[model samples]
Target: MKTLTALFTAAALALGANAAFAKDVQPDEVVKLVNAKTIKSLDELKAAAVAKHPGSTVTDSELEDEYGRYIYKVELRDTQNVEWDVALDAKTGEVLKDERDN
Candidate 1:
């Protein structure tokens, strides 16, 4: 029983270490999606993320395709100097997550 519990704990840690690394949509695909109006522009997505934490400045961002979902991930630093992680749906400009980074 202890061995099984250990395996579960280790697996969870491994998964958490690399939470989003499966499929990344290519740059060409990103342009196509934007032109086709299937997804919002990266600029738009970034703005949406920043709006989540007012007075926050974006530090880094990336577009990824997670199991067919176009996710826009943004890292930011707020006016108070707190780091944050934000995720948005590229298509609808929805804020999926807004968490403060440790």
Candidate 2:
């Protein structure tokens, strides 16, 4: 039983480590995702958001394929301690998921 438990623990750790790397996004697909939405450019999104919400900053973003569509992962926070994790549609500029950060 002790040996079995040790093997199980090792397996779990191995799985956890493998999950750490971020998934790859093909360059062409990424452009299609952004262009289809009429986003034009990443700088445009940043500028618009900053203008709307002063003091808030977008820290990081990534494009991912999910549910047969592209999703943009956006993370931001403001002086008021408001944290935002939003997933926007790559083809439509629609908000797919918006959650308040804990």
Q: Flag regions of model 1 displaced more than 4 Å.
A: 9-21
TM-score of 1: 0.81
- Put down candidate 1 lDDT per residue, 22-85, tens digits, no spaces: 4777889899999999999999999899888889999998888876788898999999999999
- Please, what are the lDDT tens digits per residue for candidate 2 over residues 26-102? 77765764677533355655544444446888987876655455556778787797987776665556666667778
Candidate with the greatest lDDT versus the true structure: 1
Error of 2 at 101 (Å): 0.8
Taking all chains together, each candidate's TM-score versus the true structure is: 0.81, 0.56
lDDT of each: 0.90, 0.66
lDDT, candidate 2, at 14: 93
TM-score for predicted model 2 compared with the true structure? 0.56
Query: Which portions of model 2 show Cα errors greater than 4 Å?
Result: 1-23, 26-29, 32-40, 44-54
Q: For model 2, give the 10-residue run with minimal summed lDDT.
A: 44-53
